[model samples]
Target: MNATATFDPFSPDAGTHQGGALDGHALVQGDYGTAVLGYDLASQVLRDKRFQNSALRLMEEFGITAGPVHDFRARSIIMLEGDPHLRLRVPLARFMSPVTVRNTRDVLRRIVESINADLDDSAPVDFYRGVAQRIPSLVYCHLAGAPASDAPQVQSLSERTLSLLTRDRSLTPVIVEAYDELFAYLAGLIARKRAEGLGDDMLSYLISLGDEGKLTEQEVLTEATSMLEASSVNTAHQVGLVVWTLLRDREAWQRIVADPELIPAAVVESLRLFPRTGVVSKIAVEDVELEGTVIPKGSDVHVAVWSANRDPGRFERPEEFDLDRERNQPLTFSTGSHNCLGQGLAKAEMEEVVRHLAEHYPDARVVEDATRIGQAGGRWLVDRLTVHMKP
Candidate 1:
């Protein structure tokens, strides 16, 4: 199977799946013989109860299974499902309550300004370094109530953990060490939050839950570790890519600057084109049929959300980066059992960041080629982006 592995994208070559013509990649439209492509609308059915999610299947695809082995060290709601997943989500949802999110806007605004204060105006400073990465980190750190000193450490851990994602899991010890440091740091924070009680901070929110017994001390540490990566790393790579895409496409750049309203659409379109979040692995339980293909019981199923978003049948000119094109919503936040819980907060972050860029730095343009970081899930960026604007 390793010999037959190939990457699929919903672009011009996408005629294979949705354009009514199978080309390149030997993609069999409806053939179900061990093919990785979505022959049966995998996403639609995975959440359906007819199928089961088994742990053995997960072990094949992802080393980490969702079950709690020895307490909840890395166990997060993202890994859980059904009743267990729902139980955790219910309490966690309170942290992201709309009232709470609304209150964070001013903080977000200030964060963007503080990070972007000194642009590399000489030529093009690396946007990733200057603002894209910093804003999200600062915003999340503030929300979590992490101390000033821990912000940089949290950022480093996010970067290192993401780096391990793309690897073949060969560097286990290094990855283990990276996580050890991160979890240890979070564990300490949890202790602090427990003593301090609920306050006007993200730590306080978690502490409130602990007091209510909604979250255990162990769960608190696990969630803190999960929260930082989910909040910062993806946003950093995403914003960097979106900015790069717009800068290259003159017309798209103009559209954003002129209307500013289209930024949200652009954000969605960008996610489909250059997904920076994840290429998740889902475990399958019972045997499933799709387009004449039967995935045997206990199999590791990989659904390419990014690839699905690019399907020509669902999207016209699927690969051309057309924000105005009529298409179904991309799975950036996903749907059903494991949708992103922080989606509401993430959207607000993207909207605020983009709005600020257009309104504040209308003249910003790319000065050099953007270099993207290649990690497990494809979310890393380093580039020199020169923006021309008033300081």
Candidate 2:
């Protein structure tokens, strides 16, 4: 738990200092044939600024854009920047606001209660799939106006999308097949909601957006499909990682279980340790310079969120999962113009599930290696996280 870890730029593993904590800046040493040779704090910040919704230009570099928009492209508000950013963000902000999350807690609490009901003291079970992994999917089911029957299918497709990021290109058709099926299924729900009108729920609220704003039938379909995909994939991945990290550190679990209020703090702490997205990319709109490296015009660069969260320069005992660490809200959710809009709902969901598990099953221990699905920039996985409850 050293506070003064020094990053060695010349080492074989420059990403980690002498210690294993990630120093993101040290990893980009011009080896990738880019304009810049190393990290440039000021320059990287400028690169995140979009001159003309140009972040999509980076995705085009990866070639996922050739697929139909039905593929759940990250090109939603996530990839938008500049003028398009303002235009797109305003409408979406209505649903994602803090107030909406506050109003949704009663439903979230019921979900936590229902998921925890599966816990049995007889023998160990995969706490993740039997419980942790399914909660977020249900959250989206309620949000998308889809039935609970859709949970397993939704979970599978979300994981498939995550894995497609890391697998051989040949496997893409398999991945797309899942994406297309999920989209088709959601499309049916969209049509039903339109005919049936808004139910007393979150998903219905989104459908009601069709009346007041510029939301087209296709845009509604597009937004709902993408939101459900993102809601399940990211939220579950994070919560699973949080549980895995806590089980890896028994002391932390013990402390939080003793005081359920600390569950929120533990979620923040776990996110700092195990980021869902390993790195975030931004394209440079113009040439920039920092740290004696000149990043020429039209270059793309990545800020390793996973790496930065662990940098010793920015945190004390950077390798330890210290819930009490008084650092800023870690970059697990990104920051600036592109921070997670669902942050409020995600936090509430995490807080509820973690609180229930800690308070009710204080001695539950992870019984298998958690499986993770990931991509080039990052990945997410959770499998075989069996847990045993104390008698």
- List model 1 lDDT by residue over 241-350, tens digit each: 77777766778877898998898788778766666643444445578665455666755455555555665656777768786866447766666666677777776677
In model 1, where do residues sit more than 4 Å from their true spots? 1-42, 49-74, 326-328, 368-391
Q: Per-candidate TM vs. native?
A: 0.81, 0.82
Please tell me which predicted candidate would have the highest TM-score against the true structure: 2
Consecutive 10-residue window with the lowest summed lDDT within model 1: 25-34
Clashing pairs in 2: 371-383, 372-381, 373-380, 373-381, 374-379
Q: State the displacement of the C-alpha of residue 70, model 1, in Å, after optimal TM-score superposition.
A: 7.6
- Give lDDT per model, in order: 0.61, 0.63
Number of clashes recorded per candidate: 5, 5
